[model samples]
Target: MKSTTSALLNRIEFPVLLAGLLIAAGLWGFVELMELARAATPHAFDTEILLAFRHAGQPDNPIGPLWLQGAMRDITSLGSTSVLVLVTTATIIYLLLIRRPAAALLMFVAVAGGKVLSILLKFEVDRPRPELVSHLVNETSLSFPSGHAMLSAITYLTLGSLAARFLPDRTTRIFVLGLAVLTTVLVGISRVYLGVHWPSDVLAGWCAGFAWAMLCWLAARLLQRRKVLADSE
Candidate 1:
């Protein structure tokens, strides 16, 4: 039993272990948020957090300066469908040009899968946008999970992880990954600040997005190990 346990532990690398943990945590959090989203009433924390972004008794006016609101609009655009599609297309083209068809294919699958998953979850919960505050930007989609937040996490993190593989050193890889995470986080926060999503919606988006990205990474890793997908040259 001791020897078998030791062998099992030895077979699990840090990356695999970390990805497994993240998948578990993300799925758990997403499920909890989904339950809250299905409730007839908004969760207390969701309303409280959404309200915190707006001026007291003035849901129409956000708490920040006018310029800050503009800045948030710009930041939030980084997670928009248009921007994400452009970035993903450009990355895929670059990968293809560099003779990394395997990586390009994986990238497409990861982002496209995330997009579909986001849409399904949105419809599944069928939650409406927060009416507690005025939306700084108009959004017509169902709002259980913010598409911007989920897609941003998927695209940026996938791109970041792929970039890290080719980076020369650990520090550079860490920096790229950190930037991806920061961007994802900022996008999620912007959703709440703009009054387009409840805090739980953004949180759920992040959870689902992170899990999907990590699942793709694991799939790619497995394919590479099996020689089904070529590693970066």
Candidate 2:
């Protein structure tokens, strides 16, 4: 087991390690900020920001609980276990189509791991949903680290990174990455607009999600490199 671990670590490129470290640092700082905000004036700036976002794209005259309820349903639906399961199944099919079982397995691990971690964090923090504003959507969950935001980040980013590998040019790769980021960002924003999460909650979710995605990406790259080296030998 020790030898296996050693060989695996050896395959991780130095640059990947550096990038991971940087990402980890940023995420750690963000986590600290969230904790501070939660502890001291949890209803101050973060709450205000979230409320502003909630009203930004909302229907005029406030549609009462209907739209809000629907938005809540949509966000909650996005986090359903079935979505994760279906995504994993789709990824497997895609991997089979592309003949890359190893990468597919890596993606499955990333997404599954992200889902488990998201649940754990939700329980650990147990942050309450915002009660300050009329919810555009009704939801009942621990609000710290929005589940939809984090899951979307991990799943979409993982798939996006994998997709980038298949693109033939830098422009195409950038476009794919941009789309992934946009989707993730929009999902996070939607949580706030729907009044289901605090700004800090969404921010922490983004950090955690991005950190997990990057870590998994590094792992996948390391695995792929070792496989290539083994084939050469």
Candidate 3:
């Protein structure tokens, strides 16, 4: 039995196994957050996290210094639609220029599809933006799941995974992926700090975004293995 189990594990590619686990965990987490989002009473978890960003006595004042607030705004912009689109376009162009049209097309579809999915989710949930605290930036969209958080995860993770394929060193690939996750997490946190979204919204965004990105990665992997997509640059 032990040998059989070991052989079964060895038969699965490590990357595929990791991606499968992430997808399953993400889907489970998203469902849990959905329940929270639909509840009439706001969950205590959301309120506590939302208030943590504010100053002790002043709800209007964020916890960080003035410069920190400015820095956060800049960090948050990394997840904005304009910035992400520009990055995706530039990346696709670079990939094409390097004679990797297949990789470039994959990049385009992954990010673009993620955008459509985010929009669909926003309408499906029809949850309103948080009014518990003042919004630091202007926003007038349904907010059961944060668009910024989700898109940032999708964009950064997809880009990072693609970049990893071209890198030769194992450590370098891990670093690239870690940076992608870090950027995604920071963007999600910034949305809550800005008071534009509840904590649950960001959680749901992360869950959905991660699952979608992994699925895309897995699909691309399968295609490459089948000679339908480019194996490398």
Candidate 4:
């Protein structure tokens, strides 16, 4: 029994353990945010943060300069459905062209699965978009978990991690992953800045998005170990 336990422990590497912890933390954070979303009144923090983006007396006027609002619109579009679809499709095509069909399929599944999950969570929470401030950009969907934030995280992080595998050096890999995270963070912040989503909504989106991305990564790792998915050459 002691030997068996030792062997099992030896198989659990630090990266795997860290991924497991991140998944747990993400899920717990998401659940707690969901409770807040379900409350009748928005959390004080959510209101205060959302209002902070706008002028003190005028909800219609955002805090930043005109150019900044335009820039935010561009950034937020990075997480838009059309843009994400384009990016995911292009990446999948590239992977297929390189003869990495397994990786391509996994990428498709990760993004598609995240999209469906986002829709389900939005409906489940049934939270309306914040009306405390004027929306800089129009959004019609139910807005508990920002679809833009969650999907951006899932897509960018998945692509980043996958691309990192094919990179030749550690620094390049880290840079790619860092850019992905940065883009995801910007997208989330843009949602808030545009006053289309509450702060909690973005937070929930990040939690769920990170968790789902990590879950997919862990699954891919397992499949590679089992020879079900070929490792990147």
Q: Which candidate is the best by lDDT?
A: 1
Local distance difference test, each candidate: 0.94, 0.75, 0.91, 0.94
lDDT of 2 by residue, 1-233 (tens): 99999998998778587758857875895678567545845757676676565445643323346666566556555555577678778987988676777777778888889989988988887778876666655577788788888888888888888888788999999999899888778778777766677877877888888888888877667666677412112
lDDT of 1 by residue, 40-135 (tens): 998899999998998898889999789999999999999999999999999999999999999999899999999999999888889999998999
Candidate 4, residues 1-233, lDDT tens digits: the string is 99999999898998898889989999999999999999999889999999888889999999978999999999999999999999999999999999898889889999999999999999898999999999999899999899999999999999999899899999999999999999999999999999999999999899999999999989988998998888454
Quote each prediction's TM-score. Answer: 0.98, 0.78, 0.94, 0.96
Off by over 4 Å in 3: 1-8
lDDT by residue (1-233, candidate 3, tens digit) is 99999999999998899999999999999989989999988899998899899977677889978988888899899999999999999999999999888878878888899899999989988889888888898999899789899999999999999899899999999999999999999999999999999999999999999999999989988888898988456
lDDT score of residue 22 within candidate 1:
99
Q: What is the model-wide C-alpha lDDT for candidate 1? A: 0.94
Better of 1 and 2 by TM-score: 1
RMSD of 2: 6.4
Q: Candidate 2 has what TM-score?
A: 0.78
Candidate 4 clashes between residue pairs 3 or more apart in a chain or in different chains: none
Question: RMSD in angstroms, all models?
Answer: 0.9, 6.4, 1.7, 1.4
Which lDDT value does model 1 have at 156? 100
